[model samples]
Target: MKVSVVTLLQESNVENFNSGLEVLKKQTLGFDNMELIVIDQAESKSEEQIIELAQLAKKANVRVQHDNSLKVEELRGKYISFFDFNYSTSPHLYKNLCQEMDKHSVDFVSANLITSIREDRNLAGAEEVIGAGVHAMTGLKLINKESLLKMAGENKIELSDSFIELLNVNFYLRPFTFNYVNKQFYRNKFTFNESYVNNSISHIRYIAEHVDLSASKKSVSLMKVQLLKHLTFLLDKNMFTDNLSEEEQAAAYDVLRNFLGLVSKKEIQSNDLDGYTPLFNMVNKKLDEEATHYIKLLRSKRHWYEQTNKYKQYFEKNPYDLEESLSWKLTKPLRLFNKWSIEVKQWFYKVFLLTLAAIWKPLTFNRKIWLVGEREDQAEDNGYFFFKHCRENYPKEKVYYIISKDSPHLYKVKKLGNVIYHSSLKHQLYMLVADTYISAWTFDECSYPAPKEKFIKMFGKQLAKKFTICLQHGVIIHNISPYLHKDRYNQNLIISSSEYEKKIIQNTLGYSDQEVAVTGLARFDNLHELSVKKQILIMPTWRRHLFKINKSNFLKSDYYKA
Candidate 1:
């Protein structure tokens, strides 16, 4: 009963707080020893409206006060608990927390926050008080004011910061036991706003100040990893998408720079970073100031194209080091093995396959031997549809679809005829004689038995005579020029589903007019007669954290579980 529930109120959440007052009136804890303090911060409300709201709170025996500062000492209750109008809580949360606090004699009792009932699969609570710094600050917690004041005094943190101060108290002050009440008393409904930019800065500062680099190395690294992931999300979701002002963008930049400065380069260079490696590496290399200026230009409506060109010029002047990239280092072994395998395959083809070329040469002489494939192992995507088209329409064209014999989708390809096993002698010979190579991915798919570079080098004139068509897996929306540019993948022709997509490919990917064809996706051919169903389909994009991870590790990822 000696619990004082404190909540901050503003004009935006006035109605929400009014509803919350109704819930407080129905609390199991009697109002005689309990008090609800609503600190009003909304400036638009008139004096009459304030009085009416105070009278309404008075009906529930709650006190409404207008204050610019928080005076923790003025609280009459032995414990102070922070609550928000954005969340829904049970009537017995206060009573249950107080009971646990009394029984365990703990300084604070942390309750579970089930944001989504479905996401609370791992209901096993925190095993250490350090975990309180994470879950406790965001969710429901009842703190003994005596212990809080003592901790704040010893740690030299003011109570005015509220949740941030409480977070510091949780981390810095030792022997402050936090008992976790294994019950879902709260459900989160808070949406992230620009305030998140400032709040994240505060959390980053707290970690930098409190987490010892040498003593808690693992904790420090793990915290940095988590913060970097958050910064990446904030960069993509809020900074780029939200119409933030220049000052807000600058603040977001500072948050990123502060994180980069906190963690070492080795740490930054080791993680996958969820497609944020280039941005992080660029900032880490002291190009932060220049990059910040150019990045701001990208957010501007009027100066986007002009500023983007300047940004690209700057990037070209200072390109990222591939040897220093995380992906490059991680794939070094695979790349080396691939190179060695290519050398062996080319040697065998030159020594053995050329001897049989006399007989195979007769079959492909002035003929249209079309070779088709999707991936090295699978037969799906645009390749399958286009191959199906070729087999049904051009029966005498000698069309063959390449697929690994071990593929699960091999049956799908075999159902249509002329299936060639990938990496076989016949597949390698087919690549050499084929007049046109069609693929769903890159041009490299056509040269699977040997490396694309090796094949081009071994038979430059022959490759020139032959043509490679890219039936792209999907529309080109993102700037993936580094992978598809003319300097990277040498496809004779690139198919596009739309003129806009073709323009993006031409302008961003450095392709010429003759190279890109405005052909809609082949999969759409089947959609003409397809019936609409009374169902919804949700297709989330791929998560970078799961990339290159083994099946076992991927199955255990938080992204997978979520």
Candidate 2:
């Protein structure tokens, strides 16, 4: 099997690059089965400097791509290995990793690494390790290219430097066997600096976002290890200086708050110190008074879960168990009732629409169209685009927009001339008379049965025809089965960006190729005309459970502060 040794060259240090390439050449033999892919990302390097580096790579028989745009589909390799420019590997590392993987029939294998950082001195062990905690991507490891690609997905072209560690953790969390070759195969010459604290904390926040505490035990263990590692690093005065900036200190506080908020009080109590009492003591002695105060607060604040009977009853029944609680069992009926109520309400609405369709006159071809979006509270997405297009191109076309009762964009949609804005509840008459229906989401709000209703709505008569056009909100990243519910699949035309997305929609939603239109998203038009600004826009989606508990204080969340 071929191995692609991928190295990201972020800095324009030709000397370092040459040295790293030379080390790779000297350490590993038989370049026939190996391909070196150098990703050059030094923006400051001129054309001449880039050409020089490319020439060096060409001499070494290595392929070079200028920039960090890595499309895994374009790469040719059975196994992909990552290396840092500052690190040197053992000659037999690749061979050893391959042997270990084959011996154990594992997905990937990583070996212990020797780093310049003093904290990592005791990290290397003689015994073979097999778990997610081995930090697979950090050191020299041969990963199954297919598995890594599937986990990372197509959109993740390149990972930010701060997030690489989190990527490794996410990869290891997958349900695959991982093995550690009980030997130091790589040496890291780079030393940890002041940014280490911030990076480590960012990683903790990443864990909080990605990891499901209720799902995987291995993930939980890894989270604990990462937390402890960050804490230990903060406590280590030898590594960390006392001159932390105000911003850094504030960031540390936010990280601690988020960390405490994510984990349970019992988990903290159970794993506190964990035989690292010396490190704990050092933290108390060396850490600043403000840092110590945050730590104290974290230790004292009761986890929200602890107050719930769902947690208390679980432990009361079995202290060491990781199963669902009696409280969850007791609330099952209530949960089912809520779900049943929503479905029943949807059914009643559909029935009511069908009843109205039976008596209502066929739609009149008057160039009138109705538009709606995913959320009732906004006039955005494809629906908004279609509305804008109609106003500019087809001014004679009578357009009506459906807005929720409390929609914030109500005034904005009403300001458009010759456009009628109707509350969602009072739009049934408009739906019956409208020539066509355009929407960014499913037509669940206006239940119009296809084939029958399609004939009535489009041809202005009882002739067989279709009317509704579905302008999907975004590109499909994962399986689209969840969103293809109710009347979504019954739409006459489903707008898609590319052939790949069309295929995904076809396969997932069981839509015929003819029914799906490969047109670009309407909102993305004239994107290049927009002026660039030096501002960050954060759009966070709401979670039901969190919102239900702390709806008022959501804006004050540590996540938002960070």
Candidate 3:
């Protein structure tokens, strides 16, 4: 019964391991067959975090290795049990794992599939796919490490890139014991890549942080660590499909609807938990008529199609052009601000239309140039909103929504009436023109470009009487002008829907006490009021120029010397 413990060190879950360590120590003191190995990979010996592990080792007489990982080749002859920071299983997780040998010869034990808590034989032993746990708190017991080493060779504990598909299917039926102890600890954790896709309203915060709804290619591509992480929980095969017996259609319906409830964007139309579902699972379940219907509904708006086509067109242009243009090279702030600007313009365009009253407005002058922005997602926008609003609210006034040159409805929009159009984000004179410059959430306004002449014209003397209204879109105040800057966007008419945001502006951005207004956000206000009384909030802050520092620390930064 000799047992060896292996753990991935550098995780911040000291509390999680605290309880498990206590349990392991108790088990070790009573049983002479255990040897615990806690790898401390902390960069420096900060006693605050890891020194206690050494003390635990001393108290339990277990070996604790610092700053080194076990070589899989060297671990060959040992019976090993590995856990990440998340080892909150019942002690029986280990005790029951040892019971697998009684069933038959076993190679390894996995922490994915679990027995039914209901204890019904009909449901018991049924395989439950636990994709989220893959590579996360991966706990495995090797009945024969020598056999694994021979099988894996130098492959070690690292999962091969190709094998990720298997894990993606929830540790596909590998030869391991399934412990029915899976639980989701991270709240509001999404199962889908919400941060990867933009203009997708699945989750507002992630959409604000990760995806851009306007770009065709958006930000939805896969990350290596993300792709690697969700796999290890996979079994050797997908045995759960077998449970659909007699209810294949029903099972698919459940899975897809279950999935639909997961991946949908954050619109007020349907289930708003789109960011939490797995797109691959939706595809797997899409074989049925109802599932297909849901997927089509999931892709629902033209936004999805437009974005898809845009990405298709981009890649189609040269086939391999992205190797040079990807934004991963920039830090988070730059990448996010770039996304925020594009979407704010598109948001200004799309949301304005739904609220406008009239249908057409004449273009009084060619001077009114409409410049389409860089929202490649191609999500549809409503030039009509601005036009109709202008005509109905203030008739005889010329108004136009600038659209990208590649906009599909360029001709149709032109044919609508006297509306004018432009194709690039570089359009000027509009922000500099007329008595007042009004925008819902145009990026060209909120973000200060004062240092550059192009951006400065926005705030130039000609635009002095200009009243630029910020229709706060995304939540999170990081992209707004820096706090140190004396002036922020035309501060006279600043408005926001979030009270928290109003507070944030006053506290962080240093808005003049009288100039700011807490007018509700328009795009989501109706949705918030009518749907579930949920109004999205958007206050902001920039990226940590150095490391992960607390907001409190940031607030205290002006006060702290260090």
Per-residue error for 303 in candidate 1, Å, reads 27
lDDT of 1 at 492: 88
CA lDDT, candidate 1, residue 422: 86
What tens digits encode model 2's per-residue C-alpha lDDT throughout 1-562? 3677787776423436656766677655456567788777766665766776767567444777766667776667778777777776777777777677667776777766653223233332212121223343345667888777776676647655545555565545556567656564577655455555556566666655665345367555645555545544573332232334545555565655555555554555565444444333433444444454444344334345456767689778877543387877788899899999977876676567656655553443444455444456667777777777777787776676666556787676776654443433335545655556677876544333333343244434422233767888788745656466324447777888999998888888777878899988888885757888999997654333344322224445665566
lDDT of 1 at 397: 72
Stretches of candidate 1 off by over 4 Å are: 45-52, 56-61, 116-137, 154-173, 195-225, 238-240, 265-275, 285-562
| Best candidate, lDDT | 1
Which pairs, if any, clash in model 2? 27-91
TM-score of 1: 0.45
Q: lDDT tens digits, residues 13-71, model 3?
A: 34455555656655522334565666665464346557677565774536677645345
What's model 3's TM-score?
0.31
lDDT of each: 0.68, 0.59, 0.41
TM-score of each: 0.45, 0.43, 0.31
Give the poorly placed runs of model 3, Cα more than 4 Å off.
Answer: 28-32, 43-49, 56-61, 72-78, 112-143, 154-562
Candidate 1, 394-505: lDDT as tens digits: 8777899988889999988888899988878788777777878888986464536645575567666656677888999887876676777888787889999999999999
Candidate 1 or 3, higher TM-score?
1
